[model samples]
Structures are given as structure tokens and as C-alpha cells.
Target: MDITVYRPGELTAADRAAWAHVQSQAVAMGSPQLGNPFLSPGFTFAVAHHHRGVRVAVVREEGEPVAFFPFQRSAAGVGRAIGLGLSDCQGLVHRPGFQWDARELLRACGLAVWEFDHLVEGQKPFEEGATGTYASPVMDVEHGYEAYLGHLRSHSPKFVRTTLAKERKLGRDVGEVRYVHDERDVGALRTLMGWKSAQYRRTGRSDRFARPWIVDLVEHLFHTREESFSGLLSVLYAGDRPIAAHFGMRTPAVLACWFPAYDPQFSKYSPGLVLHLRMAEGAAADGVAHLDLGRGHKEYKESLKTRDLTVSEGWVTRPHPVALGHRARRAPVRALRNAVTAHPVLREPADRFLKRVGRLRAGAR
Candidate 1:
């Protein structure tokens, strides 16, 4: 086997075709997460336009491409999953049964240390490197929208009933309520971004839109239209105004939820949840088999998810002083976070503390 690394933009047409083939073959692996839109070459190329650090490692067997590993490398030789914080799905897209040494792959890319959260499970080479694993909720919509509604009625009847009631109330109090799954209007996308940015600030989290590159990347994705991967903006409108919106990516098989927010004025109606339900229904109608909610803990996720998928978080490092130093600095913090996230007892208090800090920050702003 031969390994070569190239900038995402540098990959030739043939190379990209091969990458897509490997990613498509991943569907046969039986895990819908393996077919995540974020893992597609189109997403990698979209991100590369705004991020110069992005690179792809192509592994070839007997001169035939067999695997593609996408990552972002810093000048200091540290690496991370392609889009890192913004990308919910992370892994090397490889042919089934093919394997390689994670350390060797890192060396081939000139990376001393590689860190990832939200690593899709069943990644053999990186499996042993995982320090922790978490459940990523998903809505199986292959059986169609009606079946999905049936699932909600069975598992979370009250949630579905109340959400529908609120939807009706919103229409009555405001205006006609409607949903558009693939909204092409750029203004709607910007509205979603603005709402999400304010939400991050209110929650005491770093605003992703504050970074010029991420903003640019999102804008680029909004316009990207492709079969293997495409950006989807779903909107729930009250008459002519968009009350709730979501910006996510979708392949034919999977719709990966990314950013979701709603007009605060309509918070009482839980429009965000309504938007998700609409997205699931719309996605199913579009031939998508699943809606990956990504790896996170939230009441909404628990209420809507039909099942869970495992995602791992950890570092894969080559033997080096820099690698050891990086581990020493990050391990403890990661461990503490994992502990808190694993237990509701700790997580609830941590969430409350963050909210308190958020209140202070919002006041100062």
C-alpha cells in the first residue's frame, strides 16, 4: 500500500472520484453514520476553500485508491478532523475490511498529533486510540414520514401532540404556518446564522460566526449543490416570515443536522422542534434514510431520537516529544469533561454554572 497526502483542492478529478467511490461503498458497512454527508469529498472541498490547513491522505493498494483520510494540519504539526469543531462526523473513509496503522498514517501526513471528537465508530485503525465514546442520536426515517410520526407517537406522544398544538397555535396567532425543506433563499440562511450567533452568545459559547473563515465556509456551502453532498437550509415560516430555520448538510442517504435556531418571539411555540420534525419528514420524502442528530446531550435529542449511534473522541499520536507534551496538556481536561458529560448529576450543575456565566456575559454585552 502507498500513502500520499494532498491539499483538498489539489486532488485531481480521478482522485476525487475515487474518494467518492470509497465513501459510497461505506454505506454497505451497515452504519448510517459511516455515510454522513460531512465525510464526503464535496464537504472537504467546500471547507478547503476557506481553510488552508485542510489536507487529504489517499491510501492506494497496488496503485488503486482504497481509503481517504481528511484532516486539518497546523504549522506546529498538530492535526484534527477536517472541520473539527464544526464537523459532527469524523473518520477515514475506507473500503470495508481495509486497515492501516493510525500512527503511520499520521507520519505520512507529517502530523505529530491528531485529535478528534465525534469520531464515527467502527473506524478500526483509530478505534484503539479512543479515550471515550458517546451516544449520537438518530431518527430512522427510511420507513417514510408517516412511520416516523408513528414512532414519535409511540415513544414521545406528548412531545408530538404538544408540538403540533403549538404549530397550530402559531398559525392562528401569527399567520399561515408552512415548512420548506430546501429553501434556496440566501437571506433566510443569513437570518438563521444571525439567530444562531446570538444563541451562542446567550449560552456563553464561542460564536462560530465570529470567525471569518467559518462564516465564509458556511456561505460557500450554502451555494454548493451536488449529489454526494449538498448544504440544506430548512425553514419554518409564519406567513411570510421565517420563524425557525436549520442549516445542515445532506447526502442521498443521510441528513446531518448542524445549526438550528428559531425566532425568540416564537420560543413559546417551540418552533425549533417543529422545524426538526418538518426536516425529518422532508428528508424522508427526499429519499434520505436517516437524520443524524449528531453527538450531543439535549432534551430535544432524547425526545426525538429513535435510536443511538456510538461516536468516539480521542487523540492518535506518533511517538514524539511534541505528541507527549500535547497529551499531557489535553488529557486531564478531556477526562474531566467526559466525566461530567457521562453523568447527569455533574452535567446538570455544570450546565447551570455555564448559564449563570452566560447571563453575566450577556449583561456585559
Candidate 2:
């Protein structure tokens, strides 16, 4: 096997095709991280305009590609999986039983430590690494929208009634309610971004939209179309105005929910909740089985989740002075994160402080 590395923009058409082929072969792959246009060369190109650490490592045998890993290298000798916070699945796209080893790959890339926060369980590279796990709430959307509502009613009576009542009131007081899955409305996306940014600031968190590359990448992704996975923008409108919107990716089997936001003016109506219901309905109709709500501990997620699967986030470090120091510092932070996650009361204040710090850092940047 031969390993070669290329910068993000330097990838040729053949490289992309090979990469896509590997991604398609992963059984647990979702469209949000692996197949979305945001993770494509064009979007990565836009991100490369502002950042300097994008690279791809490919392993080939007999002059054919077998595995591909996308990552970002930092001056600190640390590397991160590409689309870190924005992507749900992070790992090497490889053929079955490939010979790549996680630590060996990091060493070859000259990285002291490689970090990831959202990784699919049992995936290569991360499978044997030291890690911690968390559950991502998901809803099965296979039995059609009405069937799902029935299931919700049986399982979460109050939640279903409240959301449905709100929807009715929204239509009566606001206007006729409408939902568009795979909406072509770019203005709705801008609206979602604005609302999401406001929510971030209100919670004292860093606003992702403040970065030009992130903003542009999302816009560029919306316009990109592909067959296996497509960027989907779902909008809920009232009287021709978008009240709530969600941006995610759709493969044949899954609808991976990424970013969702709603106009605060419709807060009482729970427009976001209504929009999620509509999204679930659409996914079921389209034969999508699961709606991956992503990793988080929000009350809505818990209420809507029928089952929970564990996912992990951590680092595999090299045996070096710099790596040791970094790990030593990170140990306390990881312990704190674990403690907070186990106890919501402890987590809330710490999360608040982190958010404040993130906002300050954002403001400085």
C-alpha cells in the first residue's frame, strides 16, 4: 500500500471520484458529513480561502484507491477531522479490512495529536482509540407522518398535543401554514442563519456565521446538487414569510438534521417544533428511516427520541513532550465535561461560562 497526501485545493477529479467511492461504501455513512456538498471540493475550496490547514490522505494499492481521510493540520502539530463542528461523522473512508492504523496515520501526517468530537461508533481509526460516548437522539420516520404522530401521541402525549395545538394556533392567528422540504428558497436559509446567530449570542456562545468561510460554505452547499446525497433546506412559512427553517442533508435512508432555527416572533407558536414534525413527515414519505438529531442534550431531543445510540469524542496522542503537555492540560477539561454531562445542573453553568468565553474570543477575532 502507498500513502500520499495532498492539500485541499490540489485534489484532482480522480481523487474526488475515488474519495466519493469510498464514502459510498461505508455502511454507517450519512449524507451530512460524507455526502453533503458542504464537504465537497468546491466548498472546501471556499474554506481554504480563509484557513490554511486542509489536507487529504489517500492510500492506494495496485494504483487504485482504497481509503481517504480528510483533515486539517495546525501550526501546533495538532490535526482535526475536516468539518469538525459542522459534520456529524468523522473517520477514514476505507474499504473493508483496510490496513490503515489510526496512530500510524497520525504519525505519518506529523501530527502530535488528532482530535474529533462527533464520530460514528465502531468506525475505523476511532474504534480502538481511547474515547468517551454520548447518545444522539433520533426519530424513526419510516411509517409515514401520520403513523409517526400516532407513535408520538402514545409515547409522549403532552408533547404531541402541545406542538399540534401550537401549530393550529399559528395557522389561525398568523396565516395558513405551509411546509416545503428541499425548498429552493435561499432567503429562508439566510433567515435561519440570522436566527441561529442571534440564538448563539443570546446564549453567550460564539456565532458560527460570524466566520465568512462558514457562511459562504453553507450558501455554496445549498446550490450544489448531487444524486446520492443532496443539501436540503426545509422551510415553514406563514403568509409567505418563513417562520422556521432547517438545513440538513438527505440520503436515501437518513435525514441528518444539522442546523435549525426559527423567528423569535413565533416563539409562542413553537414554529421550530412544528417544522421538525413536518420534516419527519417528509422523510418518512421519502423512505428515510431515521432523523439523526445529532449529539446534544436539549429537552426537545430527549422528548422526541425513541432510542439513543452512543457516539464518542476524544484524542489519540503521540508519545512526545508537546503531546504529553497537551494531553495533561486536556485531562482536566475532559473530566469536567464528563462530570457536567452526567449532571445537568453542573453542566449548565459550565456551559454558560464556556459560551461566554467563546463569545469573547469571537469578538476578539
Which candidate number maximizes lDDT? 1
Across 88-115, the per-residue lDDT of candidate 1 in tens digits comes to 8999988888879988999999999999
Give stretches of model 2 more than 4 Å off.
Answer: 28-50, 348-365
Candidate 2, position 93, lDDT: 64
Specify the poorest-scoring 10-residue window by lDDT in model 2.
Answer: 30-39
Query: Over 4 Å off in model 1, which ranges?
Result: 29-31
Candidate 2 similarity to native, TM-score: 0.86
- Writing each residue's lDDT as its tens digit, candidate 2 over 2-107 gives 7788887677877876666666555454422343233344445545665689887878899998877777888888877677777765666676667667777787
Candidate 1, residue 275: lDDT: 88
